[model samples]
Target: MSGSRSVADRSRPVDGKRVVVTGAASGIGKGVATALVQGGARVVLLDRNVDAVTAVADELGATAIGCDVTDEDQVRAAMRGAAEHLGGLDGAVNNAGIVLNEPAESMSLVDFNRVIAVNLTGVFLCAREQFPFLADGGGSIVNTASMCAGIVVRPQPQVSYNASKSAVVGLTRSLAAEWADRNIRVNSVSPGYTLTELVRSPELAPQHEQWSSLTPMKRLADIDDLVGAYLFLLSDQAGFMTGQDIVIDGGYTVW
Candidate 1:
């Protein structure tokens, strides 16, 4: 009781909380990890990139695990380790994902399944594995969905990516309802098109113009622009919120 915090302090937007973040070695994950540390939360960074994640952990004074979300064994092991390190799990940000830009006509089953595995199945695994850890403390879960989940990406082919993201939305809603009794709120953030290494690829560069034009804001989202939504969802401030999709798309989905 000597080190205990007041209720108000714990309820203030992720203060002194412990959280696990997937894909946390770089990009949006890195941004979230940085913000979480600044906001006073102990963060566990998980990613497929071992060295990179470890380096990030050292830099941020956070825990790091090299767990690929698509692999159940690795995820389980990582969660166990994270819980051990943090004393318990209070929330998680499942942000690990990949994208494929193949046309439906030429898309192979293997490639399509790969996308689903990482984007859809990965989320499912994280949520399921996180339940045991979160239920005890009334935890929060925020999955990274996309505006493409609700709206189609144009001037390119990404049928697999679109389908996978769409499934994430449905998954979030279904789990939110079923898990409400445990006080484990579930929600998602649909970032329009955030500026990150993934989006800065030479192949995706051309599509940037189309994506910006579609959004009334005339620009893609920066990682800075999207971390706040995630921070809110994983905080007690969103206690009354669940089964929701906070679309930070700059009005892209509005049209």
Candidate 2:
């Protein structure tokens, strides 16, 4: 009669959890949504690109909603739609981001503010709308940040990107603390040099290569490679985890 228990003591786990993933039409968001679906969760894919989102949603048989993440009204409507379609919302991935790569000197206020608005304000808007839905089920949130949050990513100075992602880390922690009593866990994943369509662009590939070389892995990460971390954060397996930024940067921050 010690601390041991029978096999039945184990919980049924995170199967059947309903999660909303923004920017799910492609890249890391799509990968996370796909992984969650394969693991038996109901996923709602929200993206600004309606056609691509529709195609992906059709392929995955998930509910798809097209909305601009930066628009508060659209973000709220999307969350409402997700709640209505999924019957209830359990979690969300605030992964919609825009990258503007230019030298800081040449970067204009308009360009800088645009990136901040989408990357930082967008995450806040999504989370603000999603909290009530998720609180109903007491769930987890995993935001997609970047290695630039903690590290000095020089040579290709994306000052706005760096600032926005750093703010994400802070926001995740703050929200985690604020909602701990409600059993709403908040966390983030900071991926480094992830290979996406954006990375493959002629303007970004060389920078991507440079960043990849900086990582100990010596290669850029596939979007799928970041899936496990998201899964773990959203699943009950990480129940004790909150207010943490799980860096999946292949040791890029070590230097």
Q: Which candidate ranks first by TM-score, i.e. highest? A: 1
lDDT of each: 0.91, 0.87
Residues 31-79, candidate 2: write the lDDT tens digits.
8888888888899999999999999999998889998998999999999
Candidate number with greatest lDDT: 1
TM-scores, all models, native as reference = 0.95, 0.94
Between which residue pairs do clashes occur in model 1? none
Q: Candidate 1: worst 10 consecutive residues by lDDT? A: 1-10
Residue 196, model 1: Cα distance from true site in angstroms: 0.6
Off by over 4 Å in 1: 1-12
lDDT of 1 by residue, 59-167 (tens): 9988899999999999999988998899998989999989888899999999999999999999999999999999997899999999889978787789999999899
Supply the TM-score for candidate 1: 0.95
